[model samples]
Target: MDRKQIINDPQTGNKGEAFEAYDDIPANPNLQRTIGDVIAARYGRRELLKGILGVSATTALFGATALSAPRPSAAAVSPEQGRYNFAELQWGNDETHHVADGYDADILLRWGDPITADAPEFDVMNQSAEAQLKQFGYNNDYVGFVPLNEEGSRGLLCVNHEYTNEEVMFPGLGRQDRADFAGMTRELVDTEMAAHGGSVVEIARGNDGKWQVVRDGKMNRRISPLHTEMTIDGPAAGHPRMQTSADPTGTRVIGTLNNCAGGMTPWGTWLMAEENFHGYFWTDKLDEDGKPDLSEQPEAEQMKRYGAPGRWYAWGKYHDRFNIDKEPNELNRFGWVVEVDPRNPDATPVKHTALGRFRHEGAETTVSSSGRLVVYMGDDARFDYQYKYVSDGVVSEDPAANARLLSEGTLYVARFDEDGSLTWLPLVHGEGPLTAENGFASQADVLIDTRLAADALGATPMDRPEDAQPRGDGTAYVMLTNNTRREADQVDAANPRAESSFGHIIEIKEAGGDHAATHGHWSILVKCGDPALAEVGAEWNPETSENGWFGSPDNCAFDAEGRLWVSTDQGSGWGKTGKSDGLYGVETEGELRGHSKLFFRCPVGGELCGPYFTPDNETLFLAVQHPGTDGTKALKGFERASTFEDPATRWPDFDPKMPPRPSVVVVTRQGGGKIAV
Candidate 1:
C-alpha cells in the first residue's frame, strides 16, 4: 500500500483484509492452494464452460527454507553517540556556510534567507517566488557538501525542501484553492510547485577556514519544478508512455517532486529522489479544450493505481489538469531518480530512467569492487521493489564518463531466496521473464514503469524501503519503514514478520559483500521494538513466532567507524505504544544484533530525518521536521510558535518546557573523542 492509505487507531492490523489478494501471493502452499480453490469453488456459477486459472507465475525466489540464526555484532554499531552531543545546535542560521572542528554549524538557512539580491532577505510574514529563488529558501532536507580542498576546506551544499508549510510561508494561504475536483488552479498549483524541489549552492571556505555561500558563485542555482528543466535518460526516455501535452515527444517533463534524502555519486554528482510525486496528479477526465475526455484508454488502470490525481491538498480551490484519466501518460514522468551535476548547473538534470521509480526514497551509488556503477534505489511505498541499475557501459571515476554512464544501463529488480541469497534479475527486453504480452513492451517501458514491470517479473515485495545506504565495505543497509497491513500468511522468510509495528533494518551483501556482484546475500539485521514495552501489534498467535517491535526506521547513515545511525518516522499515528519520536545510533558488532542506543531525540512534534555524514565522518547532520506539527488548534489557542513543551522529549538536556524548534543539528565531541563506538 502507498502513503495515502491510512491505518486508523485500534484496528486489528491486517485482519479485515481478505486472505487472498489479486496483487499479493501467500507464501504458504496450503494457503495458496486454498486461495485457488476458493476462487474456483466460489465462482463455479460464473460460466459453465470457462475454468478458473490460478496464479500463472509463483516461482519460489526464497531458497534454503529459512534464514540462518540471528548473529548480532558490535562492529556494526553507529558511532553517533560517542562522537556528538545529543542536544547541541551547532553552527546554525549564520546566513553563511562555515565549518569548524567543534559543533556550531547547525541550522544554516532561514525561510527567506536571500540566495541573490534579486531574492529578498528574510521576512517570514511576506514571501514570494522572486524573493525565494534568490534567498536561502525554506525547510532544507538532505545536505551534501563536496569538499573542494583535501584538508576539507570548501565545498557545495545540495539541499532539498520536501514541501512548504504554506501557512507559514505565505500570508493567509492567499486565494488558493485546495479542491481535488479539478487538480489545482494555476495560481494555487504554482505555489505548491515552487516548494517541491532542491537547491545547489556554491560554498567556499574563507581564510578563517569557515565556509560561506558565495553569491553569484559560478555554479550556484535553484532547481525547482516551476523553472528547472530536466532531460530523459536510459529506458523510458522518448517512450510513448511518457508523452503529454506538456512534451508531446515524451522526452521532457517539468520539475521533480518531494525530492528527499539522496546520495552523491562517487563520480561527482547528486542523485535526488522523487518521493511523493503521486500526490500532484489529478485523475478526473477532461480534454485539452476542456471537453469530456474519453473513458476507454490503454492506461486507465495505471492512472487509478497512482493515486488517481486531482485529489486536493489542505486548501480548497481546483484546477483539473492533474487528472491523468484525461491524460494517462502524464503521471509516467515521475518516481525516477534524477541525477544533478552540481558542477554544471546548466546541464539538464538527467532522469536515470533505468532505475525503476516508485515513491523513490533515495539512491546509494558505489563503483562495485569490479568497477561497475551500481545504483541501489527503493520504492518507498509498502510492498514495492528494491532495484539496482548496473550500467552496461563500465564505470570510470572520471567525472565526465560517470555522467554519461547512467544514461544507458541494465536495470535489475531484486529477489530474495529463502536461503538468504538474493539475485538481481534482468529487467530488460528480450531477456529472461520480460516479454511483450506481460506488459513490458520493451526495456524502456519496464524501466520507466518499474513497479508494474517488477510485479510482472516476480520481484519480492518489501515493506516500505527508504534510503538504501552502502557501508564502507560492500554491505548495504536499508530502512524498511513498518508495514501495518501485512498478515501472518504474508510473512515470508525474508520479511519474517506480519503486520510489523517497529520497522527493521535490512543488511544486504553482494555475494562476498562485493559491491559489484550480480548476485548477493540478504537478511534482516535488526527489528525495531522496545525490549521492555512488551509486544505491541497483534500477537504471533502461538503458531507464529514473536517478531518483537522496534519503532519505524527511516533514513540511515554510516560514520567513519562503520556504525549505522538510524533516524525515525515513528511519530505517525501508526506507531506502537505511542512512543515519542527520536533518533537512534545502533552499534552493531559481535553479539550486538539490535543494540540501538538513543543518540538524539527531536522535539515532541518533530521527526528526525536526513542523517548525513561529512566525507571525513567528523560531523553528523540531521533535519528536525515540524517541531510543532500538531498545531491544529485555532490561532487564539495557539501558544507562541515554539510550543514543543507539555510532552517533553529533550534530547541533549531533556527539558519539558522548551519551545519546539526545527533545525539541523551537528554533533561532535566536547574534547575530540570518537563518537558512538
Candidate 2:
C-alpha cells in the first residue's frame, strides 16, 4: 500500500476519503511487547484455518458461545427475545433514511438552516461566514441535549459540525486540496471555517410529539473557528509551547475545529472533543517529494507524532496560525476536549488541557461510585492508546465547583495485560516514564505531548479506539473501530485479531465496581463482521440476523434502559459490505448477550453519527453526516465523486436546487411511545 502515491494522485479517491484512508495507516512504529503481541501469546494462537481468519484462536478470544450455533437469518430473531424489541430495519443503500416500522424519523435541523431568531434564510448560492455563524453548521456529528425543563420537553441541542465536504459545499469549487486550493477564496475559506465547530440551539416538543427547532430560543448560538474566542485551562493552559503569534499570552486562542463525538456533563455543560484536528492545517512548504516540509520546524518530532499540518483543507492558506511553518505551536492548541456552558451564551468555552491532548474521539463523562467525575475517551487513531481522566474532586450541588473538576484531574492511559486485566497508568508529570528524563519537563509537557508520553510508558495500542461508553454498573465499553494494518504477530488479548477490518468491541468491568479504579477485567464483547463468512471471523450471537451484523463500530450509546445501541462510520470502506452505515441495538448481557438488531440506517454515501436518546427514551436524535459524498463511486450507477452539481441523492429535501444536506433527525415511536418498545 503506497500511501504517498495514493495521496499525490488527484484522481484516486475524494479529498476527505483519501486523507482518512491514508490516516488509518498506522503511524506508530514503536511496538515492542504491545497489546497485539501480548494477546497472541496470552490466547495461544493456532494454525490459520483459512486466508482470512484463525478459527480456533478467534473462538478462544470471543468465547465458544459465539459460534455454538449457525447465525440465524436476518429476520430470525423475535421481538420478545431480548431488551431491544423493535422490528429490524432492513439494511441496504438507498436515497432516503429509514427506521423501524413503528417509528418516525423527522428532520429537525439541516445545514445552513436558521438557528438564531434573526438569522437569514439559507441561500446556497449566496453564503457568507456572517450568515453561517447565524445558521446551522455542516456535517453534524455529535448531538447532546441539555434539558431546560424537568420533564425534558425543552432542551438545548449541542450538535458538533465535524467538517465540510468542499466538493459538495461550494458550487464550482470542485475538490480544492489536491489542486493546491486554487479555487478557494478568502470568503469561501472563512465560510468553511465558520462551519467547523459546534451549534447550540434550543429545541422543544410540540403537541404532536415531534421535535422542532426553537428559532427564537434565547440561548441559540454558534461557535466556529472563524471568530469565536476561547480560553485555555488546566496545566497546559499558559505553556510556552501553546504561545502563538496571534495569542502571545498563550491563555487565549481562536475557536475549536473538527469537533466530533462529545458528551454532556451532569451539571449541564457540553464537552466538545476536537478529533482529527491535524487535517485542517496547511503548509505551502513542500519537499521535492511534494510532502509537507517540516525540516525547519523546531517541534518537528512532536508535530510528526501528532500528524500536524496535514493540509487537508485550505484554511491555513487564509489563516496564518494553521500553517505549521508560520505558527507551529497552534496545532498544540487543539485536540483537547473543550467544555462549553450551553446554558450561558456569555460563557467563554475553555479547552481543558488536563484531559491530555490526542485525537480525542469522545469525552463521555460519568460519575464514579465514589462521586468523582470519570471521563472515558479514545484516541481515534490506528495504533493509538485509550485514555481516561479522573477528577481530583467529587461532584457537589454547586455547579461552579464542579466546573473546576475538569481543570484538576489525573489522566491515565490504558494497558491491557495477557491476564485479562486492565491497568490505568497515570500520566502525572513526575510519574514513571512521564518525567524530565523522557522529554516531559512539567505536567503541561506530559499533557501537551500525551501520545509521546504514553508511548514511553508502553500503553496498549488498540485498533482505532473511538467513543467508549461507560455503564452505570462500573463497566466501560471501549470501541476498537478497525485496524487492517495490524499483523498476525501483533494480535493481543485486548484486540485478538490480526488484520481485523470489521473491528470489535471490548467491555471493561472496573474493579470493585468503581470507574475510578485503576484496574479492571476486560473481554471482547463481540467481533464485528459478517457472521455468514467464516473466514471473516465474526462473533455475533448466533441470533444476530444478516441485517444486524455491522462493521466499523465508531460511536455507541447506552439508552435509558441500559441497552447498547451502536452507530457505524465505515467511510468509503462501506463498499466492502453491501449494507449502509446504520444504528443497531446490541445486547450486552443475558442469554442473548451478543445479539444485535438493526434499528435505523443512513442514506447512501452517508455515515451514521450521534445516536442520542432523550432522557425519557421517547426520542432518538441521529446525525447523518457527509451524505451523498463518501463511496459514491462504489455505488453501481454513481461511479464518480459526488458534488453539489451531481450528487447521488438529494435527501431530506429532494428539491432540484438543494444538494444533500447533513441533518439532525428526530426519531419517535408512532403514536407517542418509548422508541423500539
Number of the top-ranking candidate, with lDDT as the measure: 2
lDDT of 1: 0.56
Residue 620, candidate 1: C-alpha displacement in angstroms: 2.2
Q: For candidate 2, what is the TM-score?
A: 0.97
Summed backbone clashes in each candidate are: 63, 6
Each candidate's TM vs. the true structure? 0.76, 0.97
Q: Residue 671 error for model 2, in Å?
A: 0.3
Off by over 4 Å in 2: 1-4, 8-11, 47-68, 488-494
lDDT to native, each model: 0.56, 0.87
How does model 1 score by TM-score? 0.76
| 165: Cα error in model 2, Å | 0.5
Q: Encode model 1's per-residue lDDT on 340-376: one tens digit a residue.
A: 8888867888887877756777787877777777887
